[model samples]
Structure formats: C-alpha cells, structure tokens
Target chain A: MSIKTSILSSIGQKLLLATSGLIMFLLFLIPHMGGNVLFLFGPDMFNSYAHHLHQLVPIVIGIELLMLTSISVHMIMAFRVVLANRKAADKRHTLKSSKERSLAARLMPVSGIMIFIFIVKHLLDFKFYEKAKTTLHGVETYDVYAMVLSRFQGDPVHLVFYVLFMVAVGFHLSHALQSSIQTYGIYVPREGSKIKLISAVVGWGMAATFAIIPIFAFIK
Target chain B: MSKQINLTLKVWRQNRGEEGKFETYEAKNIDTDASFLEMLDVVNDELTLKGIEPIAFEHDCREGICGCCGSTVNGKTHGSHERTTLCQLHMRHFEDGQNVVIEPFRATAFPVIKDLIVDRSGLDEIIAEGGYVSVKTGNAPEASTTPIKKEMAEAAMDAAECIGCGACVAACPNGSAMLFTSAKVSQYALLPQGHPERAQRVKNMVAKMDELGFGNCSNEYECAVSCPKGIDVKNIARLNREFIKANLGKN
Candidate 1:
C-alpha cells in the first residue's frame, strides 16, 4: 500500500498514534517537566528561565505550532482508534477483562481525557494568564514564577486537584511510553521486562516532579 | 473418585441472524474431572431430555489443539485459564454454586452463529492475505546449511503455535486481530523460507486486516493473555518492524 492509504489503515492508525504521542512525550512533555524543575529553585531562577524563554519568540512559536499539530494528531488518532475498537467490539460478554490486563492499560482513555482537561486548565492558568511585570537578568518579562505560586498558594482544593490529576498523568504515561515502544516494534521482553519498569518510572517520575510545584507552593 | 460440583450456567442462546440472550441452566452432579465442554454436554443432554433444543455451541477434537471450542466464560476468553482452551478447561476449576456466564466470542467481524459459536472465517481471511511462503523452495535444504538460529526458530515456532483461535479477538477491547496477524507475520519474518515474500506478506496481511473492519490494537496486551498458545506481544512489535521495513523497501 502507498503511504497515503497506509496511514489510514488500522495498523497505520496505531503507528500514527504512537508517533504523535512520542512527539508530545519527547518534544513537549519532557522539556516542560525540565522547565518546571526551575520553580523549585525559587523565583529568581524560575523568572529568569521564563524571561529567556520569552526572548526566543520565534523558536517558541515554532515549538508551539508543532505541539499544536502533534496534540491534534494525537487526539484525532486516539479518537479514531477508540471508535473503531468500539465498533469492532460491538457486543461484549457480560464478564470481561482478563486479570492480567493492567489497570493502567485499562484506564488509558480515562487518563487521557483527564490529562487533556489538566492541560487546558494548566494553559489557562499559566500560559494565558497575565503575569506581573518583572525585570529578570536585565530584561523585563512576565513573572511566570510568581504566577505559578499564586495559582497554587493557599488553595488546598487546587493543590489536591493538581496532585490527583498528576496521578492520572502517571497512569497514562506508564502504559503509553512502553506501549509506544512496542508499537514501534522494539523487542521489549514480555515478562519482567526492564523496559516496563523504566516506563513506569519515567511516567510517575514526571508526574511527581510536576506535582511538586503545586505541593511546594501550597505549603510555602 | 473425582468430586462433583454444581454450576449455574448462564449460556447465551440465539438463532442465526437473531439477537442472542442468556438462557440459564442448572448443571448438577458435574464431575470435577469433566472438561468444560463435557460439562456442557451433560447440560445439553438434560436439555434434550426436556424436549428443548440443546445449547448450540461448537466443539471438535475435544483436545485444546483443534482451536474449535472457544467461548467467553465469566467474561474471559477460553475460560480465563492461562494457556488453556475451553476443551481443556476442567470443571474442577469452577466452584460449586458458582454462576458461569458463557457466550460466543463477540466481535463485529466475528458474528455469532449459534449459542457459543462465532464465525471465525475473518481470521482465515486474514491468513489468506499472505500468511505463507508462496515461493516454494525447490527441495528441503540441508538442516546444517540452513543455519537457522535456535532463538529465531524458537520464536518462529512460538508464533506458529497460534491455532487461529478467535480467543484473542474476544479478549481484546478493540477486537483487533493484531496479535494474530503479528504472529503470522513473525512466523514468516523469522524464517528463511519467508524471506522471499517478507515485505509483501506484511503489507498484504496488514492491508487485509484493515479492510476486514478489525480494530487497531491500542497496545492493551489483552490478546496475549487470552491466547491459549501463550503468544506474546513481541510478535506484534516484530510485525510493526516488518511493516516499516516493507514500506521502506518499496520506497
């Protein structure tokens, strides 16, 4: 089959989902997590990082556009795959699911929807919200660090919600990372595989790191 | 003497092209040693004696290898036993007074033919899409000359063990044939005989699978769990690799 038709096929759709998901995981999520780490270093480091990031407008715009495309593709592919699966599994036995199926794997779609909500709320609060003006490293830029603090500070409900959603992120990524590797046809051992362990670590690790900001802000 | 257990079985009943429903039957004095199919046989006999048509499930070769007997029992494909087919599933595994929900493997591609039998011809159609080495090797090459790596052969053999049972489809949330197709692809991809048609095989089989209205695998690994042969998801990874290699070769 040609590339055009191939991409529309069932296996092709999975390949698309895996590719788009990996794009987000690598280009956006990883860097996003790394930048989030700066918040823990106090306002100076965090504000300076944001200020420098704002200076790279062209690169940032380019990444944002790319991320837009990736997220769109990822969402579309997931939607299509889920619909097709629902159709294929038209009738289900009342009794379902082998115990061997992981809860993380089963909750993928649920976690996915939760993450999407988290992203929107996150972007609205941080990306779109106006930050107080600040001079950082001799440049006037948004006080992104302060903005993050204000959002999470003294709001127990907000802190709890943030942490809860991080658990959702953990669930989604734990399965997604390894599943994507397998979809790419890498030989990850089936039983007791180190790749599975690493995937879970990276998944929960990022979630924990991201959650730390809200938690620390709430306490401080 | 083997102990006996009674089970309350809620078996799905339907006519061809008709909507199915659960019809419960009481199976008393079932010997624990009796296979699941034999338990059904006893149930069928009672139904026949009552002047009612028996549960119209399918079975052959009472052994697990025929891939003939399969049903979703308690929501698990092939009765939820790891690496066990329905025919090999014994009554001993069931608890007395337990309620068993038995139904056909449900998938859009796998239409219910009767009570517990589904038309699994879709699997055969997928196999037809190039699950073979069409290019005949003129003669059997010397085993020494072949130099097949033991690991590769073992993997190939593992894949080839797939009996084309529809259990994987039944277990999958998406009803995807990925595991089955991957196994077929891997069986050929790993063997030298399959080298000649390697690229074409993957491309064609994948194309057919898509064309047949099967769902894409979301990497749930449910299929591997339901497979009586214990087929691993690694074959699917191999299939993906083969697909990429095949497409790249064409380009």
Candidate 2:
C-alpha cells in the first residue's frame, strides 16, 4: 500500500488520528495548561505571560496553522472511523454487555463532541473576545487577567460550565493518551501499567490545572 | 449423585432470514455434572418428546478445542467463566433458579443462520486470505532444523492457539474481528517459515477483514477479555506494527 492507500485504510486512519492527537497534546494542550498555571501567581504574572505570548507572532501563527490542520484531520478521521464502526456493528444484540471497555473509553466520542463545543466556547470567551489595553509593568498590554476575572467573577453558571467541561477533557485525554500508544503498536499490559497511571495523572492533572482558573476567578 | 437443578432459559430463536425473538423454556432436572451442551441436549430431548422444536445451537467437540460451538449466555460470550468456552461451561455454574439468557454470537459479519448458529464463513474467508504459508518448502522438515528461540516459539504457539472462534467479534461493541485476525497475523509473523510472505500476508488479510464489513478496533480490550482461549491483545499490537511495516513500503 502506498501512502495514500494506507491513509485510506482503517488502521492507517487510526494512525493519523493518533498522530494528530498526540501532536496537539504535546504542542497545544500542555503549553496552554502551563500558561494557565501562571494565573495562580496574581494578575501581573498571568497578564504578562499572556501578553508576551503575542510577541512570537510568526511562531504562534505557525502553531495555529498546525493546530488547525491537526484538528481538521482529527475530526475527519474520527467521523469516518466512528461511522464505519457503527455500520459494521449495525445488527447489535439486545443483551450485549462489555466488561473490559472502560467508561473513559466508552465516553470518548461523547467527551470529544463535548470538548469540541467547549473549545469553541472557550475561544469565543477568551481568544476571540475583545481585550482592552492596560498599563502593566510600565508597558501597555491586553489585560487578559482582568478579562478572565470579569467573565467568571461572581458568575456561578460560567464558572461551573468551565469546570464541568474540564471533566470532558479529562475523559478524552485519559483514554486517548494510552490508546494512542496502543495504536502505535506498543503493548501496554492490561494490569499494573505505568502508562495507565501516567495517562490518568496527566489527563486529570491538566484538567484540574485548567479548572482552577475559573474557580479562583469566580471566588476572588 | 450430582445435584439437579430446574432453571428457566430465555433463548433466542429464529429461522434463516427471519426476525428472531427470545422464547423462554423451563429446563427441569438439569444435572450439575453435565456440560452446558449436555444440559441443552436434555432440554432438546424433552422438547422433542413434547412435539416442540428443539432450540438450535452448535456443538461438535464438547471439550472446547474444536471451535465448533459458541453462544452468548446472559450477554457474556460463552457464559461468565473466565477463559472458558461455552462447551466447557457446565450446568453446575448456574444457580438453582437461575434465568439463563442464551443468544447467538452476534455480528454483522457473522450473521445468524438459525437460532444460536451464526454463519462464521467470514472468519473462514479471513483465514483463506493469508493465514497459510506457501514457500513450497516440501515435505515436513525436521523440527530441530528451524532453530527457533524458546520465547519466540512459545509466543508463536500462543498466537497459533486461536481456534478461529468469533467470540472476539461477539464481545466487541463494534463487532471487530481484530483479535481473530491479529492472532493469525502474529502466529506467522513470529516464525521463520512464514517470513517469505509476511508483507503481503498482513496486507491481504487486513484488506479482506475491512472488506468483509468487520468494524475497526477501538482499543476497548473487550475482545481480549472475551476470548475463551485467553488470546491476549499483545498480538493485536504486533499486528498494527506488522501492518504499518508492510504498508509503509518497508519491504
């Protein structure tokens, strides 16, 4: 099979999905979570961190393009693989039960769709939202800290929504992290796997870090 | 004397190309020592005397090696015993008043022919694809000539132990045959004799598997858990690597 034909194959499509997902996990989500942690240190640190990120315009644009491509491929392959799987399993038994499929694995597509919606809402709430200039460290910059505080401060609904979607993130990452390894042809033992531990830790840990922003902003 | 139990069986019943439904029957005087199939035999005998149609299911080797018999009992493929086939499951496992729900191994690829007997010709087709070696290495050579490593041989044998049963498909939520195909792929891929056709074999078999309306694996591990032979998903990981190597023009 050539590259094109293999890309069209079922396993090949899965390989593509795993690759794109890992790229986003490594490049995008990790850095985003890292930046989010600065929110805990106070307004200047957090706002400055956000402001300096705009200095790397070319690099950010390149990363954005890469992310755009990755997300598109991920969604497309997910659509095809899921639809094909459904078609193959059309005549399901009424009494079927799965003992080995984890809730995280079972809820992948659900969390995926939820996470997609969350990303759109998140970008609109922060990325695409207007950022007014403020004097910080004797330099004019976007007051992203104030923006976040104003959005979630005393707004229980928005705060809860942000925190709730993190669980969806947790669900997706917990499964995708280990699943990508298996798809790449690495054997993760069914029991006592360190990879499983790391997956859960990183998945929920990142979610917790992201969730803390809205929580602190809501309370403070 | 072994204990006898009376039970109710809700069995799926259907003819070829007909809509199916579950029919409940009382199985009285089931001996605990009897294998699940023998219990079914007793039920069939009773039904025959009563002029009712005997519930149709498949069985050849009552000991579980032939891969000729399988059915989902209460939603678990081959009942709830770990690594035990339906034929190997005994009546003693059931409670005295248990309600057993029996059904065919369901999959779009393995369509039910009648009652619990599904047409597993799809598996046969997958085997025919590349499950054999054709190097023309004439009459059986001495076993000592091959020089197979101990661990490698054991792993190959492990992969070779799969009986082509469709339990993996039935257990998979997506009706995937990945476990079955991976076992075949791993057995050959691990041995020296099968190296000559390695690249093409994985390619052909996977294509056939996908072409036959089997679902893609979702990394759920259900197929691994449901296999009566205790076939691990390690073979599946190897298969994914083998498929990549074969399809990536690495040959």
lDDT of 2 by residue, A28-143 (tens): 99999889989989989988998889999999999999999999999999999998888877665554566567899999889999999998999999999999889887999999
lDDT of 1: 0.88
Q: Tens digits of per-residue lDDT for model 1 on A64-114?
A: 999999889989989988888889888685747765578998898899999
Candidate 1 chain A worst ten-residue window by lDDT: A91-100
Off by over 4 Å in 2: A94-98
Please give each candidate's TM-score.
0.95, 0.97
lDDT of 2 by residue, B6-111 (tens): 9999999999999999999999999999999999999999999999999889998777888989998988998988889898998888999999999899888988
The models' CA-based lDDT, in order, is 0.88, 0.90
CA lDDT for candidate 2: 0.90
Can you tell me which runs of candidate 1 are displaced by over 4 Å?
Answer: B137-145
TM-score, candidate 1, is 0.95
Q: Pick the candidate with the highest lDDT.
A: 2
Candidate 2: RMSD to truth: 1.3
